[model samples]
Target: MGPPILSAVDLDKSYHSGSAELVVLRECSFALANNERVAIVGQSGVGKSTLLHLLAGLDRADSGEIRFGDRDVHAMGEIDLARFRNRHIGMVFQFYHLLPEFSARENVMMPLLIAGEATGAPARADELLAEVGLEERGHHFPSELSGGERQRVAIARALARGPEVVLADEPTGNLDHENGLRVMEVFERVHARHQTAMVLVTHNQELVSGFDRVLRMGPGGQLEQTDQEAPR
Candidate 1:
């Protein structure tokens, strides 16, 4: 009924490699609605992460449009784009991009700090760390934590901003099966508490059972639902 939380139309992106233009996304188009959970499954190099970047306004598409509600994401200037991203978008990458110098709590507090809330950030950060099951590890730096712990910290950092839609690029990629399930549980907790929409790019079909939809990226850089499996 309402406008989708995010959408892309006739999107295209490519990489230039010294006289060779490698096309990655070809007329890619899709949307994720409010409180919806979507899983993207495909083999390596299907431009899944690329599409996520485009959707997040981290990178611009070569042509076509990406919209966040009524805002044209592809048309915003740098400062406006940065503000918009900080206010409304959260991203978790396969490699946890936690700052090495900061503790887990500090890393999770950065977004709030940037938004100019100095007083209560630590408490908010505590809430996020606890939600992700990392409350005990908040004092540890990224190098001091395990791979799974680092990823959980990253997830906490992503949720710190209370973004409307979270874009996760292989959020569980490097974890063991048990760790992967644990990370997924943190996602579930986030959804239950915040009702954030999520677009997750993952290879684990087993994880798809927890999402509202599963769409696979084809060789042509187009997206298609694998089957009409009922939503979870």
Candidate 2:
């Protein structure tokens, strides 16, 4: 692999509580190469989400550096960071987070709309819905879709801006086994089709098996490699 598309070094984040400080991450470090699909698994409350936030530049670390390609994400100004994130990173959450008032097509078009590409939003959104097997359901509202379908919309929304990376946090947590499997399949297929790097924070080992690598977060915010290759 060439230089990492994403890299973090000596990351540290903490919170103040009364007179004490609660440390979330301590010198956390990792790297993700282009087109790599990686899983970070650990028990709840191990700062898995925090790590994801810091990596995505959704949150900042008290100390350390987060680099995307060669640029320092932490060092960028707010506007530039927002633009960079929109253009380079996409995020999917366990909760679908769609607009209840919008149709599936409209919901998927949000990123493009925010990016001021209104003219092409409809076409791109329709294409993504079809790619995720939701073409016929484009007119449906969030309330009209199943948990899996909603997540599919969320995934399509994440890809709306044609981001280089997709960061998913417990994406299948709300689905049943069958639907969860289907969602994972969607993620795999989308990543393959787009050649986008993915950083997935999940507790499900089955989902982790399909990834290129798995890293487990140990106590004290240390990361250990679990797998070097995807399972057959």
Best by lDDT: 2
Q: Estimate, for each residue in 169-216, the C-alpha lDDT of model 1 and write its tens digit.
A: 998998999989888988888988999999999989787587888899
Worst 10 residues of 2 by lDDT: 223-232
Give every collision pair in model 1.
none
Residue 163 shift from truth in candidate 1, angstroms: 0.5
lDDT per residue as tens, model 2, 89-207: 99999998999999999999988988899999999999999999999999999999999999999999999998888999999988998999989999989988999999998878786
- The CA lDDT of each predicted structure is 0.90, 0.91
Candidate 1: how many backbone clashes?
Answer: 0
The number of clashing residue pairs in each candidate reads 0, 0
Error of 2 at 138 (Å): 1.1
lDDT of 2: 0.91
TM for every model, in the order presented, reads 0.97, 0.96
